[model samples]
Target: MTLDDILNTHLGRRALLKSSLAGGGAALAGTLFGGWIPNVAWGADATAKYETPVVETASGKLRGVIQQGVHTFRGVPYGASTAGSNRFMAPRKPEPWTGVRDAFQNGPTAPQLGGPPNPLILGHRAPTFESEDCLVLNVFTPGVTGKRPVMLWLHGGGFAGGAGSAHSFDGNYLARSGDVVVVSVNHRLNVFGYLYLGGVGSEKYRDSGNAGMLDIVAALQWTHDNIARFGGDPSNVTVFGQSGGGAKVSTLLGMPSTKGLIHKAIIESGSALKGVSRENANKTAERLLAKLNLQANQVDELQKLPMEKLLAVIDNRGQGTAGGGPFVLAPVVDGHNLPRDPWDPTAPEISADVPVIIGSVNTEGTFFMPPDSPQFAPLYSLDEAGLKTQLTQRYGDQADKLIELYQKEAPGANPSKLFFMATAFPGDAIKQAERKFAQAKAPAYMYLFTWETPVEGGRRHSPHTIELPFVFDNPQEQPDEVGNGPDLQPLADRVSGVWTAFARTGSPNTSLTPKWPAYNTDQRATMIINDDWKVVNDPRHEVRLIIESVKGRAAS
Candidate 1:
């Protein structure tokens, strides 16, 4: 059967279950489905209604629309356009306007080339619009009066691509459910955001390499100054993101400019330990200059060049992953903005007071291995011998030891499963959690999402970005990634509750889940979030041990 045929079959089965369960009440349905059943519908509570909401900001007044009891303001500018001389420079406050500006639709995404969607990863959509004038944010709130908690979401594109306007990131459900404010930001990215020009450029472009990070800082400042009008508590703001967005949160935690503006942080799947060094960033910039055949003094010519011309000089391979090359663009540890790596040797002292929730999914590797890709064909049906050979190519002498340990931990697991688990283990998430625990100033909560998605015949297995729909309480928003099963709403209710609770207080504990203990070196407590949520101490000890063994060998 074709891919569409397989998807339809899965949907048909789910529909049958729903039809059979319709006779029983929600409680009975919950009993049969292995989880709680939510009373609310996936969409709006009542008939969709739209009303204009005007909120004053530091810059000017913004007119937004309210639908289904949630006031949503989109395309709200946080910074000025970075098109001309502003290219590669720190973001500046938008010029004030006299009349109220309409924020009806999403702002432009950072100028990025689009790539074909990967069938393996669910809800894989590219940014709708691209431009240098993309320093805008979207806000969703229950009301524009009470001082509810505020959450700012950073979109993930690996510091290379992505925008806040992606459909999967809709904040209406999340904001209404938690009675909090949700903000999603769009900022400069790729060469426009991270290209380093400090060495060859004038004094004004010294902070060019870290302009994107600075844009996020600007967004935070905007929220701090203006979210109160949207009924959000600026003092109780939490920043959370997945994948590249998570790496941005990690970077923001270390930025001195983000002090006091950020109250809490959540790093999901993407844990960045360090940023590109100044030397490496400068070299990349020099290479780009050479590619353009421009002299040192003529650096201003870059600002005059067309956007297409500048983009063409670089290898704009595509988005899902950072482009493959020695000159991949990313944040720089510039002395001014970012003094050091975010979590290299240890957690940044600047964010010691900030409580954090750090976690990774069970199978992050599946997203990278699309079944149709010829390069990864062996990974889908690898035998024991093939697994050993594949592991040896990457792990060298430790391949046998890894195999023995993984088999001991997960007896009867197939060679493909074993290899994926052993290889895709997020050791960095553990290290980041440990570093936060070591800080001792703030509490750290840990979690592992092990819910295997039933989509694509269960091949994904809780892959990267799978938890996004649940976290946003919009499982119905992306049915492909999260199947349209009877259990989705309840799971989303539980997961979104955890996130909102953390934003409200500095803890993820809620009545929906069990009593989650703080992560420490002793118990290494972690909340295994799924249909049957439970707190587990060191969920994967073997994985940790294997990581330690790898480090030990590397050190020797």
Candidate 2:
């Protein structure tokens, strides 16, 4: 109950003095609480009768700040400044500005590591200033024209820490509750965005192991060339995120310069089935040039050494090991920039005409457990012989048939809530949305969220970023990870109306939830949400066949 007491109990006090007056007034009070103009009252000369708002773009003119009616624009700059020799190369663009620039603030935050002490794993509240000339972005719009429909977002910290100016990703409540145009970005992370250094020296550092996914493909080519002067709809954008920005929308649906620059995508709780295999990204770039002893023709003196000695050799080489070991930073299939393994073996016929949604969160390992472990506060008083001695010491000999199929799918559940709902299943984001609903030609939804944050006493279940302030309708910006509830504004108006009706129309059919369907491979339909939204089908189905028989015994 603190984050300024749930932002002064739901943004009051003249919307916190119009969000401490500036930086686009806290992104226009995080987009006027989404249900448009809920009670627009600002006085004390409403910051001397506001009026800022500029626009333009093909790399110039910005200004921004409208407010109640929504407009925003913080930090802007679509690329350039990955800092000195453009760090690990490949983002470029930006350099065009001339007048009207003052985009109000925010810009600077890709040099991470000021996060994760489990404030619900990365959705942490404070700390937003960092740098390395962080590529910048942030918009929020509701006007500049009428084309509309364009979301973008991406934040999550997995590619190595977040920042699309995270105040819980304030895109002013999904740009005035889906009038659309949101934006967000801030690129490059860990060792300046996945350092690979192909063959060490200079082939102009090839694609330096995907420079932070080509700085989200140069901010989707600057939202396909300046999102229609902020009114949006650069061919109906819609790339969403949650968890490492849903693994950067599953690596931009296997990027080929993101075919037609994204039509739609969602991905929450980060699915990312694979990447980082140019032989473990060139043996983690020759173990970061033998820990910066530097050779292979001194790889341009390893880009002139600083960035805190390449983040102290990626924090003493620990970024590599999720069981395959030795490849540090992420994103790198690199056969000409991520040539394979997006949804793994399929789903990338150049984003088979786009449309996707993916999901997760139902005790996502209680926001990645270990909050000062000693079996983390005795896993909420585990018994039944400490849940059969921690499920026969982690399922050896298939621990009594996986604790009798999760005690018949959660009965009196507790071996730390059946080990955080058997490691929060959405088995690799539903096997990458069941290989894009069995080879897409567009259309692949699926969801699970299952709300459970009654805050601490409920032990933050339904964790891993409890559906980002109910999908940015801003559940009062992390009321200490979503609490002060009036049952979370009708589940943040049915999860921001099924993500702005799947970004205008790729299909998330709103009117509060039901007929979702689409994810096929027979009845695997899903949707679940919570506070009563339905559409189930294979909801649990024996924990998806025991997580596909424990990943076929860990891929044999």
Candidate 3:
């Protein structure tokens, strides 16, 4: 069926049980992060008023609208307010509102300080409404009878900054195109979401270092209870995200409470290498208390302080980089919410037996490197002497193998880009890393977004999040040739088509797209995405093994 054709069909929802989240470098010039929001102009006529009526969920009733071609229900709280006394504690269910709460405009997002104007990332710097009562979710469901498969999206901002409402992430297209219910959420960010509070001695604040993750699981509960009313099948849900969201997805895969809630997952551009250790988490929490000149016993006093005052102290804790910090967070592995070091354990922790799909972009590192940092240029320009020093510092004594392999690949190429390629991209590496360590034994599928965007003067390679628009078929703001002229529609049709197929049957397949294979230790295959997409085994060659040969000896 044509993309919109599927939506008009109003597919029936199969009743079931319950289930389940980066971009670019730039030219050496001006790149405003929020620049691309308006560029994606759509005929999103507000004239379409939705009368979806109030959904009476177990927690409360939510009033939503069916506007602009999709049924949009916004601002539905999944958890209770994370305010004063509840601050830094595992989120509690929100009190049921007396009447139907308005579910119209986007809800208040988690408060997070933003980065500078990053050109490659459009709409990132746009003003996001923040709040303490931000544990809300927005859903877009096409049909309304039984439960359709649901896809929950996690936003990426490195755990420090990112609004769930970024224009690029609007789920309308995915819902309408995939004929599946789509959910996007807002939760606590930065210190509010991830500060380690183990030493606080309060059972309420125990999960502080990983509250963001808890909030995600809580949202899933809301979906399990209410998605059927929106024509979504609660039993077949898939969780996925990019960057921070990808990392969050991986974390959930290793969690216990989150296990049965989701059936499938996809991780885009996320790595499982970095997370706080239990001992280190406690150490960090104690250090914060010490900074307050208070004993660990005085931790309760922090609960009494206003959130605003606490945020100021958190930001000034001498821990941010100059490239305009966003998520000052790192998830906690406190033997509870998370049972062990996600990647060190023997198998996937949370839903190891579930199906999995994960991968990343080709030139993914181009996005994470700072605009004016020492690692700026690349491996190509540095002198032989300088290269040796950097290799030793980053790879330690194994610097020789690292330098030899990398030099053979690029010879005199940009080392910065090469390093990111070998060490970072193929996002599957980190996914596999987590998989290898997890006792979770689910089947896994993978892919790499190899399409290069049409934007000129920008980095030609597929940096980070460029795959988003194509994946969801987000329309281009200005008129060009495709949707509004500037869209990657043909590619979107193929990508989003495959994604919806997966939502429907846990396998992405269609006559128009290539037949994808499930990821396994044997073939170790992946779908190479582009206009001429193809599924290939042994993608990226020995780069995977070459990098793995130098594991733990990398860098922070």
Candidate 4:
């Protein structure tokens, strides 16, 4: 059969057959055609249409498509299937193959609860398929010259939902604009990833609690060993992620195994100071076992049970509720695999040599706050008396002082604006960055996404995850989140340029924005990202102190 005929058959069968079976069929067909189905046989006109760029990986060869001068590879397996016995275990390297494999479509997303339809949070297009064997990654590169920097992306679903194939994360723009290689990964999540079966089951399940994180490490190892073939410099890899992905970056920093694997790190919005404590992890394990009605010795039954049963328990466990008591499906502080808290009492020493960039949005809480909240009703039209009442009720004894301080700091600010400002201080990112700045030999940079959106009548005001499209240089994918104003493209260019620059060098400085200085305890220099980017030293210092003081009192 001709190459077009074979591809047509493949596409039709792909919908009817399992992914593994489809891959196997393609490999068999390629072998029958002498390792490659030549596009030249179809004539000059057909050659251009059928031609695919092939790159050899450590495991096998892959065929990718070229579009607009960039070669794109999708659904490339970095690890073996995480189904059956492999479930809840560390990722294993995929079996090597001999024939060319087609990587034309995205792999299945990790099995997860359906997320909100809000495009601002979940992206414009959601994954069409999800399965247990979802350990795949995508790549975008200029060419296979092995000279470009590799920027690895980790998606943000808070360790539960999301995939690397989200339309908003498409690497075409970043790869072409920066002349760099871009990669995105998908791995185990939620119960399949972080279920603590260490003490409850066989020694094989010892690392179950951290299996999801290990999947990422395995993917990095693959990149280190194979990224060069895709025109990427494995030695110059920079790992960047938003929200849960940011937490993953933070967690990787503490891992000794990650030393020398990543040269730089960027944590956007998700600032996790610590993982689940061992005690809490054990409690969650106990709860899971009780829910399953399985004895300690019968933990193997977990592997035998259908994925639906486990997922049902996860749903009942309330994994992502706002007031959820404690996160059930999260990485645990296992002394062996995950030695200690990533940045609880202090920053990790393993990543002290790795330069870092950390920051958050201006109005993070707006994303989480319900529109129907009664407390926020006065924000639409608040007189001085109403402002005082709301501030007093929320801030208690410090209300009068905070109001005065905020009025002096932001003249002509309304009650709603002050509410958002107070709630969106990015305390977590700042606190973690402070910890790293105090001890790291390498320099650290900080930024605040201050560009508010006109979406939802301006309530978005730079909420969580708003900077992603800009950072990826794909602002058009999120017009609602970025607004229809003419200023977006320029801002996106500035943001993506700085991010790619950071990957190339340790610093994020570029010609577009002002000189961004490394964050230090004394100055606390921060870059405010907007249409007009500016550097502010210790911005809103008093407000931060007040927030910290309140947290201290609550903890005490």
Best by TM-score: 4
* lDDT accuracy of residue 200 in candidate 4: 71
Model 3 residue-pair collision total: 62
Q: Highest lDDT: give the candidate number.
A: 1
- The residue pairs found clashing in candidate 4 are 146-231
Q: Write the per-residue lDDT of candidate 2 for residues 1-556, one digit (tens) a residue.
A: 3123444566664544355343333543232122232334566566434445577888788766666677777768788777778789998887886876655445667776553456553334323545677788888887888898898888877887767776778787768877898988889977788878876567888788889989888999889998898888899898988888888888888889888989988988898878888777777777778766776887777667777767766663445464244337888887877888777867788888888888888887667665456757776677767776776675556656767788887787666777667656677877777888777588788888878887677765687888888788778767777778699988888888889888889899877777898888789888888889888888768657865886688789
The digit string of per-residue lDDT tens for model 1 on 478-541 reads: 7778889889999999999999999999999989999999999889998888899999998767
Clashes of each: 0, 2, 62, 1
- Model 4: per-residue Cα lDDT over 1-556, one tens digit each: 3233444565553321222122333232221000123323334454345335688998999877665567778778999888888988899998777887766666667877774466455453347466777888989898877589899999888888778777778788899999899999999999899988886777888899999999999989999999999999989999999989999999999887788899999999988999987788778888788877878888888888887788777674444454234437898898877899999899999888888999999878777664456855546566777777877776778877787887887787777777677766778888887998888688889999888887777765778888988898988767767767678889899999999999999899989999999999789999999989999998989888887888788789
Model 4 TM-score?
Answer: 0.89
lDDT (Cα, 0-100) at 536 in candidate 3? 84
Regions of candidate 1 where Cα sits further than 4 Å from its true position: 1-49, 120-124, 316-326
Better of 2 and 3 by TM-score: 3
lDDT of 4: 0.80
